[model samples]
Target: MAVVRPVRGDRVRVYDLQVQGTSNFFAGQVLVHNCLIVDDPHKDRADAESEASRRALHDWYSSTALKRLQPDRNAVVGIQTRWHPDDFAGRRLAEEGRLEEGGRWKVVHLPAVADAKFGADPLGRAPGDPLPHPKIPTRDRKALKAWWADMKRTSIVRDWHSLAQGDPQPAEGALVSEELLRLLRDSATKVEPQKIAVAVDPSGGGRDVAGVVGGFLGDDKRVWITHDVSAVMSSADWSTAACRLAYEANAAIIYVEANYGRDMCSLAIRTSWETLQRDGEIPENVLMPAIDLVTAKQGKLLRAEPVAQQMVQDRVRLRGLFVDLEREWSTWMSTDPDSPGRIDASCILTYGLIPEANKGAIVHAPLPQAPVSGGRGPSQVAGAYGRRIGK
Candidate 1:
């Protein structure tokens, strides 16, 4: 039996304990007062023969013993959050209320479980990511208000508790965008692959560990994340895993972010591949090649924004192996706090689509066609009704 009473609040207490049918009838009397409240009333009646159990608890509550404990008329508030309003406790309280005609007991209805819906981090981070402690952004304040309003209106949503709010450990990324999540749910599917490329974001040096991602680019530029192996491992160990994934995917191009370890990533991957090949233990038939280094002049923030636009425009399609990217997308947060998952995956997708020399395509806006010139310049054109120009 666990009793949860508020230490700070005045005249408020909560108790949660499992007791047998015989024990429950007198449990309330243990802490009888002028105002007694009960929660989850229906659960206490599930196994008991409803009518008998109801009468037993009530008879005991209104007994001489309880009357002596609280001589005045005490208000028994049954604040049950059960789904069914006709459960034993609810029904008993209703009966008592009727018999006493406004004094003995009151049945209050309050829904217990609630959903915590998430919205986009306007500051550009993923959902569940923490803001710099105590530095609440204006956008977050707005999002909280919006979430409350939404919950009030719908009354049927609950947070994915195990993942979002279940742990005492703080969440790490910007809230995943609803629009992007909806798009992913609607668009993600499985497909066979023709060409494959693996991108590695190694974090072995710092508090962050390492994330090696492999994506299969099929016909029509549809991309499927084939693998997302993120863990704390030595450079050599991570290299072995990366090679294994590449070989399994039959990937030709291994793209490693060269910023962190530079040439070390490439060397480690090649060394691991050679070791595996010599040992005759390589799992797949694909040739293990040295990783190609991909340089980024811009930061991750700038790199991912364009991809988000592509997703919204339906230019990007995410298929299988989306688990890691999905988690990343669901947790990416900016300094101001926004999710950048779609953007990060988009960078990988875009890099595969457009070459460095062809970055022109990414920034191209069709030049607006120069407004067609309208047959004459301003000096030669006259106003409507034949008025002279500049008159």
Candidate 2:
């Protein structure tokens, strides 16, 4: 073990990278003075063979954490970690090696399910009051214990950067594995889809394969992806296939990524429907499927995170085997998604399933200025007497 560096003016702090971890770990007090910034316990764990080398100047700010004796301004932190591709909190930490704990968060870090330490080195002399160890189960669950044991060695280069030092990548946290998927796949439908939609991603260049996916929002609030119609078809062909899939799946909406050309994509689908009619491919009685045009202001990885989160929440399912589709998901990188069409279509499908009432980033935007009740003030002369109240 390395000699511990002295941290000046320190408090007993429990930080979190997320709101859940923050709320869970923070069980302490903060008083003025005797404050310390940090001590670099472990060097930014460098990758011997790659550009993962760490330096004092580069990590002087982000890589540092505090260490001090008891009864100070620190609490035993709890890190509530759930692996998902849409882990915005994780991504923020990964990018630029730090995010300002934005969202009005007071502190940051995840809760440890087990011991928080390096090899044989416990969490300083100030991990918890009166004891060096955290309050964890005597026998931690086997699966969780395994993750903690191998947290460093098991994760890929991308993930180690984010989870360890807050260095994020597009492909870091979405927790999907071949084993997990295989275990969940079914030979028969277990439930019926309450609502159906066909999500499409049309590429700007003809060389790219257009991604088309069909999903059903089940009564159980689980999104079961049923089909993948992604192919290297011309504009008219892909549109026609998407329309056909909508009819086959009894889908009510054809959600299309309108980023490249909104009108052209929408019109192409409709025109394809008409062409289908001309060829007697689709029944004349069926009206053209409705278009739900979607645009993307965020990057592909950002869009993917929420949907990947659905999988982590067990709110997403795969009705049948989607070998190629799952392959896209497994290899999809966060910084630059590989098979973007497949992932984009997947996002649209899951997003459509997200309840209308529960959508978008939850913000604490200040309320519009409204006159205070009781003539603007009662006890403190209009709350501040038109001047700053505190130093």
Candidate 3:
């Protein structure tokens, strides 16, 4: 094995190798073997960030690369610096269950700098300690710190954490930050809601999960997310789940996204509500929540941006920890291919609860107005308006 500089203007060429003795042999300057070695699987930064590119690499590895390995003899190895959370190495680790516990792969994670959050440093370095390098003398702690500081200063937070710390996070490009979510969670307290609603983003029997999230407008003018029943289910199942959540939360309205299946979404909820009432699942005294079909006139990112800003302004709270929903909020990016159903539903719920977040384009439903003196309250007005819209 050796490193040799290519001659200027050298033409690129490919050659086949046939080792005579050992499994390994020198090909040009580098040692080569029949064993599969995926070095920096992603082509570049853009490729690493792209979902399509990641999937392509994953497919090639699973379908093509694995087949090329010799049965019971040849080994597979992958080496890469962390990029996105869904990058090739990340996906491979997740698929093999190595992300959570011990699995097939023997992972040796060596970040340029140590971080305690990822686990103890393999080199026994404390958090913030730089990885030992010959270029920076071990005795020169000031030089080492200065070098890492320069690296961090030059790179974006996401890239610095991923490429340098080996802890990839959808931080810079993410719609919401985990830190903000945590702050909201810490400040949230149990308060009797003034108005409650359930929002749904139907999957329409597709592979995507149907999102059913419930939230309430607190007296403090903050929207608090209380429930997330999002799942991969049939039309009937999701509708039923949405209705059940609404019933449990005593939600005054059920807001369903109607961009795709306008009538189907509304009809499903109404049908489920009727079925629930007829079967005594819902008591006779409890009136069914008004079903309001909402249509989005803007792109998802545009619709969600206002709500994210509201979160930043401390207008959104979580009644408790919603793990999956929080994960979606913290990691979802505009460039991501698949629509995040949970986020969609949460945005709808937020827009419904905090009318200011709607920004006029994301929702078609009449924004519930504040109560006038000697008139119906906001909930009453909203319920009446919902009923009128339902009709």
Candidate 4:
């Protein structure tokens, strides 16, 4: 037998539009009277696009509404999932102070959504009568169980789409906060001009521009990045540019990656610094330390993870002089694997200064112990005398 479904609603009709749900926005305006509440808490492409979608919905409602849509009153709650609080609702609340810490607009953590009842109860009827809301396709326990199996196969951080907004499953991993990411972006854009450091990732063939990332480490152990400059040139050419940048920024150290260009690149950069000093081009107060080589054996991803985590955790701060750095970071994160060059190089430089987080807990290398020699010395010594004293 076929059942008839109603197109319009009387008053409050509950709809479940699930993951990547957008139809609800238009459907709600057409059928229901309430604003859409997305339970998605993770930062996904959907969340990234939410702000635009929200704007479109608002526009549609304002123009399309027969009566007042009450833009200010329509509240969307993205609960349960751990995502950047900077999402459409979160940022609006932050700026307006309309949402309080424990208020209605809050990021809630629960054992599981199943622990709480979802969807509308049709049995609890009112005088206006009832209508069924369209159900949105959601990732259920079966899909989540599958996602949990998949998570074991790869680094979850690399798969933000899955980890952030994929199947909601419990993983023994801590997710990075959006507030922290905002803080890093804010900090990087505000790096101070006086204290800075430039770490070079050199390209010797003159084909690829040597990357020079400029940032300063503050007394509070926060790093403020100012610039990330990459251009094609000879070692000397880049050295000259680096020196100028360092001088202008009053950078403390010039760290040159000595693996590819080896000692030659380091010497070239030092020589350029000296040339500027001799010509009285650089100020006396601006101290340029000797080139220091970072000798940690780790992949780019491994080395960069801590820095990224720190940025997302508010552990590292970018000061006022880092306009360029902030731009690069936003671009790099949005599109990873393609243009991570400047961002990667900058992260390496940041780690060079703040090594503790990267180094983690130190394990003591075994030391060579002295040989024990307390055997029988003479013919008279026997039995117990034959035993070693410090064996």
- How does each model score on lDDT? 0.46, 0.53, 0.70, 0.48
In model 2, the Cα lDDT at residue 45 comes to: 22
Report how far off residue 171 is in candidate 2 (Å): 8.5
Candidate 3, position 90, lDDT:
85
Task: Provide TM-scores for the models.
Answer: 0.46, 0.47, 0.53, 0.42
* Model 2: ten consecutive residues of lowest lDDT: 379-388
* Number of the predicted model whose TM-score against the real structure is largest: 3
Compare candidates 3 and 4 on lDDT and give the better one.
3
Candidate with the larger lDDT of 1 and 2:
2
TM-score of 4: 0.42
Residue-pair clash count for candidate 3: 0
Candidate 2 residue runs with Cα over 4 Å from true position: 1-175, 187-189, 337-339, 355-391
Q: Count the backbone clashes (under 3 Å) in each candidate.
A: 27, 28, 0, 16
The 10 consecutive residues of candidate 1 with the worst lDDT sum are 364-373
Per-residue CA lDDT of candidate 3, range 259-363, in tens?
778798888888998899899997756677877777653587787777777777667887677877877777666665555789988888887777667773322
Residue 85, model 2: lDDT of: 29
- 189-298 in candidate 1: lDDT tens per residue? 33345556766665454334566666655444445454666566677777787787766655666777655677787888889888887778673344564466666435
Alpha-carbon error at 349 in model 1, in Å?
Answer: 5.6
| Regions more than 4 Å wrong, model 4 | 1-180, 185-196, 277-280, 283-288, 321-324, 327-339, 360-391
Q: Which is the winner by TM-score between candidate 1 and candidate 3?
A: 3
* lDDT tens readout by residue for model 2, 1-391: 1122343223212232212221223323433222332222222222211122223322432444423323433332213222332232332244524214343233343333212331121333223212212445534445444555466566655545455434334432333554445544543444545667899888824577778999877555667788998887788878888988987776777888766778988889989888887889877776665788776535665566556555655567777778767766654554433445777788777776664312444222112221111222222211211211222
